[model samples]
Target: MRKQLLGLAAVAALLTACGDTCDENKMVSGGFDNFPAPSASADGPTPGSAADFQKNVQDTVHFGFDRHDLTAEAKTALENQAEWLKKWGGVNLLIEGHCDERGTVEYNLALGEKRAHAAKHFLMSQGIDTSRLETVSYGKERPIDAGHTEEAHAKNRRDVSVVR
Candidate 1:
């Protein structure tokens, strides 16, 4: 009986020594220091958009590279677009900003914002109601033409106007 009691005590001691060291309270408390960042937008030009928008006027506009500032050509393009909008007042215009796949994400985001602002300003200047305008930036996510050519890059770095 004495030996059995001693053996039971030793077993209890071993069990206590080898017991789970992981604190349940530690798990109850949050432990991570950093979280993963979000993925970029996957949405691009609608499939068969040109064929669809052609039947009904989209008045969509495009822009040039690294340039958020509206050029003479851009202004002329907006003028034609504004005339069309004035005739068809119900359609809302969405200014989607795009950038070449070269710059950093943050830089491209700011550039995209500037491009959208430039187009929005043009529309506002042309007396298209600002209420009907929306701005979105795809950064370098969506390339109209995916080839790594200069022409492709040039075309990619643009603010396209979509009538949605």
Candidate 2:
């Protein structure tokens, strides 16, 4: 019984030593001192960044049901987007077309593609370079509003401009 008690005490001592050594090594090698403090910017997002574009200009346009045509409101949004793109010549854009969840997947994909092209063409006409704009269709897969309502559907049928 005494021999068993001594064995347990030795094991406890070894475990205590190992715990302290591990902690010390962790403090010396993986400490927060190795990381630099983050610098904060007061002027807001950097120019030509995605945040800047979204902040300074409208980046989305809603479409009517089953329509790929650009409404006057959509045209206005695209105009603003084109101006921002022109100002930030180095920034490229990805135009994502999303659809409401009423149609078949194949049909929605085609419609979404048309919607994307509609936005892209409008931007191109407003003097944004075609080379800087790419288009993609999300069909009914990525709705902004998941609820089954007209208002939600309207919000889901949209073209969003993303900085690339």
Candidate 3:
């Protein structure tokens, strides 16, 4: 009986020693959107593989309606791209500019060219070689998102950096 009691005490002590360390752990329960948010990272993943480049470095920088100027957010993304280019020196990129379906072909094509130039100039300012970069204006010919909604239009107005 004494041995059994001592074993019970030891078991209790062991359990107490393994007390909960998850006091700060939390689980959020809510209605989730169908689309998951992009995972935020400090420096993002390394820029060696194609998958890593797509995941970590943002390939596209969005612009406002009928605008070729880069936003602060676009600048930040381009800075990251510049860093990636410097890290992976062998990469030659094509900056493809696109636009929404609202404008005429000629106007949209001009806007797209301006957008591509804007992105290329920014990358060049960040020390990326102009020789390593090429620009193409898809205008409204190609779009990643096809919906006729504002969100889709926003996505359409972008300069995509493609590995060549």
RMSD of each: 14.5, 7.2, 9.4
Q: Across residues 33-142, which tens digit of lDDT does each residue of candidate 2 receive?
A: 66543431366777778888888898999999999999999999999998888888999999999999998999999999999999999999999889999999999999
Alpha-carbon runs more than 4 Å astray in model 1:
1-64
Error of 3 at 3 (Å): 65
Model 3 quality (TM-score): 0.70
The candidate that achieves the highest TM-score relative to the unseen native structure: 2
Best-to-worst ranking by lDDT = 2, 3, 1
Models 1 onward score TM values of 0.62, 0.76, 0.70
Candidate 1 per-residue lDDT over residues 81-157, each given as its tens digit: 67767776776778888888888999998888888888888889999999988999888888888988888888788
Runs in model 2 lying further than 4 Å from the true structure: 1-40
lDDT of 3 at 69: 95
Candidate 2: 10-residue stretch with minimal lDDT: 33-42
Q: Rank the candidates by TM-score, best first.
A: 2, 3, 1
Clashing residue pairs found in predicted model 3: none
Regions more than 4 Å wrong, model 3: 1-47
Error of 3 at 130 (Å): 0.3
Q: Write the per-residue lDDT of candidate 3 for residues 99-153, one digit (tens) a residue.
A: 9988899999999999999999999999999999999999999988999999999
